[model samples]
Target chain A: MNAYWQCLRGIVLREWLRFVLQRTRFLSALVRPLLWLVVFAAGFRAALGISVIEPYDTYIPYEVYIIPGLACMILLFNGMQGSLAMVYDREMGSMRVLLTSPLPRTFLLCSKLLATALISLLQVYGFLAIAWVYGVQPPAMGLLLALPALLLVALMLSALGLLLSNGIRQLENFAGVMNFVIFPLFFLSSALYPLWKMRDASQWLYWLCAVNPFTHAVELVRFALYERLAGLALAICLGLTVLFTLLAVLTFNPQHAALRKPG
Target chain B: MNALTVQDLSFAYGPCQALCEVGFSLAPGRFAALLGPNGAGKSTLIALLTRLYHLQRGEIHVGGHSLRDAPRAALKQLGVVFQQSTLDLELSVEQNLRYHAALHGLSRRHTDLRVEAELARQGLSERRREKVRALNGGHRRRVEIARALLHEPRLLLLDEASVGLDPASRLGLNQHVRQLCREHDLSVLWTTHLLDEVHADDALMILHQGRLVASGQVDALVQEHDGDLGRLFAGLTRPTATGAPA
Candidate 1:
């Protein structure tokens, strides 16, 4: 309906305004990925030599190889941080305002996820732009091709974040998400090292990387950035985005959090 | 027809009962105060009314639409100002109001008109561009009230909306809402612990320990009990007293 479109536009506009106002958040989002690309990748390049991977047709520098992962890293952090904001919103009464809207709760939450995903794209591209300037350039067209892939990954991660936030009753519990979810999802995936390298380290660890959804998200972006298609990664990311979004919507009961404390 | 109705509404959290067999109604354009102490199930009732919590038992009808079966319709006619301020501090007053209007699915033209009207109504026209964080508590509350009325709902529920305001601001807020009720034919259900907020002519419902113990016109309840408002409220809500539930 017209109203639904207008509502989505409004939600997205609010997020865009907030994103513009929070200069530090934008800077920090860029800094984390840039750190990995500049400092960590530089240090790790000699320590880890990447062979010709499926997405890479030939030998590539460590920085180039890790570009997709680091790009996704921005999304991963932004996704979780956006959900953390949701927890804060719950405590601060803004979430209540959001939920009490006349639109269907499902639609409202989905709009939020999409808006946050769109904003995360801005950060991802911003990081990529800086990476391009840093001489870690993807093909010009490849960078454009990666937009849809980045969006899919962003939605998947944001949905996953929202799903996690539903179970997180308080902001204090978010540290656990950082340690348990973000760390494991990032470190255990192909984000830092190729799955074959993980196989060289340990078979079980390689399997964990192979099965990690973030691996698919990374591969999806990695392949797209090289102007290639990653069918399996695309399928997996799409499926998980849908599944996580559904689970988030189903479990997001504000009353559960509101009533968690005894009256 | 009554603008709002709750019949045998009850809720429980784990083994603790928060509300039990609560029933009440507000005629069109009337101002009703839901007077209750801190732990007297006021928030729980508001939560249920606003659909934040699923109804465990009983039925609520807003503007003739049932909450359980027709929540969207029911909610369309109901507006709420929660105990906590819900405005985004980083957003300008106009932006906050526009967001709310958008959530209610107002068209752009309608939103612009409503936003203009509400800003004027709340005496916030000059402060429209100001971020909510810069506004004092009273002005923020006014913004919230204006936002709530943007959709022109038949029933406006204020759950402890006057909390943290100075006495003068509190009285002014109450009077403003009362004026809205008179001018717009708006039905209001205001929840608060402050007895002074309730006037003699207003409909009064006393909720104590998860039950509606007393409800009627304030003057009639006071005259029948042969005491002032404070003594009557204390006598009914006192823990040891056996106040009959209405």
Candidate 2:
């Protein structure tokens, strides 16, 4: 309906405005991946030569191989940060205004997830634009094809973030959890090294990387960026997006966050 | 028809009961004040009424729609201003109002019209483009009021809306809301701990220890307990000789 469209527009517009106003957030989002591409990848290029994979047509340097993973890294961090803001909103009273809407709670939450995903996409592109100038270019059409793949990963991660935030009692405790989640998700996956590389390191470590949803998310982007279809990865990302979003909606208890602790 | 109704509503946080057997109703276009001291379960009752917490034991109807069975319809007819300010401080007044209107599913034209009308009604038209952070506490509260009314719900529920205001600002805000009730025929249930905010002619309800201790017209309840409002409140809500809530 027109009403839902208007609501979606308003939510997205608010996020866009906030994103524009907070210059530091955008810069910080860029800094993390840029460091990996410019510094980490440069340092490791001689040590890790990437073979031609299913998505890559030829041998590539470490920087080119990690570009897709780093793009997803932006989504991963932004997604969790978006949920952190949700916790902050609940504490600060703005969430009460949001929850009182006449729309179904499920719809409101979905709109929020989609809006945050949309914003994450913008940040991903910003990182990609900088990477483009740094000689990490993919095929022009492949960049366009990667749009939906990136969006799906964004939604999946943001939904996971929201679900995680539901159980977090306070903002002070969030940084510890973030480091716990982000490091393992980034390091254990194919972000820095391929699954085969992990297999050479340890079988259990390789299995962990194989099963990580973040790994599939990275592969989804990696394949799409080369104009290849990652059917299995696409299915897994879609399934987890639905599953996490449902759980997030079901477990969301605004009262628990909004109530004052008894003194 | 009553604009709002609650029957035997009860809620608990784990083992601790926050509200019990709470019941009340408000006729359309009337102003009723809910008064209670701190720790007296006012916030809990508001949370239940606003559907922030699920109904654990009983029923609530807003504008003839049951909250449990038909929440969307019920919520559509109800507006709430929570104890904490819910405005987005980084947003301009107009932007905040527009977001609320959109959440209520208003068309752009309708949102513009209602935004204009409510801004004028709250005397906030000149400050429409000002960021909420720039406004004083009193003005921010008015912006929330305007936002709550944009959808034109029949019932307006405010929980401790006058807290932290200057004495003059509090009085002015209270009077402004009362004027809204009279002019717009809107039903209002305002919660506050301040006794002076309740007029003798207005409907009054006192809550204590998660129970509704007394409820009726203010002057009548005062006369029934004693001639003094303060004594009546103290006697009803204070601990008894046996260490139970009076």
Candidate 3:
């Protein structure tokens, strides 16, 4: 167990170092969320009316409403970005160094997921600090409780990214998956607008948002930030994380020649 | 026990077979050469041995552990220097070595001492603080070799690690690797297409079209074909009067 922790610590430290060195990446991760919160939310503030939701006893501003979503957005993007790096590393042959360690491949992949999740957590916290500076802050205690929620969401998203990294052979295919999967997953979620707003737009879209695992991930963070436990959100996020992580492991198994072989 | 054994190794990428019934073995202090042309499955075989790709119909044992059921154990005794560089250019030499040591679960104090010893042994002691990007090709390859040995693995695999180096550097690196095998009693499987890279006394395996066309000591194998390894290699790898280059 000590050795395992040491390995995990090294992996996480390497990831943190990598995150710090890549200035453009860290800044861009922050920039995208700020755009959604400051620009998109500003534009849609008057357009979408807020109602009393379960966590909300009174009306909330559009900026406050999208804070969790922005945080989720950072995690979602960083998770995929981390997976993208994994695919690039595999192509470049660095991943072989990581995978060929004597440790179980599952544990190695888990370490990568955890490392990515921790970085995503950092970016989320950075986004939250910026959001606070912009005058939209969660309850101080709620912010503390939200750490676990952020971790859960980060795990789910990173697992999804890992699944994609194992599934896609080439980096070129990643763009298509991002456009087809990530964008739709984000827009269909209640990240930017409320489900009620989507309901008015179309019942089908509202249903899609409700079913989207990303929606649950964002809602999981949002509810936790209000010092509330979202049972449904927790269930879906945990379930998807386990399912995706298992799929990633299966895809990465050495015997899975079909998956590893170049197309 | 033999340090490494590969029996009837076969693997394919979809419809195209990359390795077909290839077999070889290396005793505990032997240096073996896997010579093949591009697309002759040398890389594929290395991949299989390193557990990057699994065998479809074959067996590979490192030390005594089978790659299939006991990969973790098998891999623990194996180290590889791949064709492409794997060093993190952002890291210093010591940092890179320490990171790999940690991955193998070495204690911090021991890892630090071992890293220093390895660096000194590899002649990189003075450059330990230099970032990987600051090092030249030969120095970088040395760093990789040093890192691979950090765990004191019994078997070492080198896949075209000397490519793109000056002739002097290439020969120097090869000599260093060969000396390491002799001094440390380490088994080595070095894959290269360069005919000159194979020593006359080294065991040689020729791979062509994903099959082992020949295998034996270099002198004997070449002696069978009129003491000409280059002609024999060319004959094995060249397209047979084809319409165009394969």
Q: Write the residue-wise lDDT of candidate 1 on A95-203 in tens digits.
A: 8777777789999999999999999999999999899899988899999999999999999999999999999888899999999999999999989888888898999
Clashing pairs in 2: none
The residue ranges of model 3 lying beyond 4 angstroms of the native Cα positions read: A253-263, B235-238, B241-246
> How do the residues B114-146 of candidate 3 rate in per-residue lDDT, one tens digit apiece?
898899889999999989999999999999999
Interface RMSD values, listed in order for every candidate: 1.6, 1.9, 3.1
In candidate 1 chain B, where is summed lDDT lowest over 10 consecutive residues?
Answer: B237-246
Best by lDDT: 1
TM-score of each: 0.98, 0.97, 0.94
In candidate 1 the C-alpha lDDT for residue A254 amounts to 69
lDDT of 3 by residue, A1-263 (tens): 87787788878988887888788888999999998888988898888767778587789888888888889989999888888888788776678788678888799899999999999998899989998999997899989999999998999889999888877778788898789878998999988888888898899989999999999998989899999999999998989999999998887754332124331
Q: Write the per-residue lDDT of candidate 1 for residues B1-246, one digit (tens) a residue.
A: 899999999999878888989999999999999998788999999999998888999999999999999988898898899888989999999999999988888999999999999999999999999999999999999999999999899999999999999999999999999999999999999999999999999999999889999999999999988769998898888885453332
2 or 3: which has the higher lDDT? 2
Task: Encode model 2's per-residue lDDT on A55-173: one tens digit a residue.
Answer: 88799989989999999999999889988998888788787777888788888889999999999999999988999999999998989999999999999999999998898888887
Better of 1 and 3 by TM-score: 1
Candidate ranking (lDDT, best to worst): 1, 2, 3
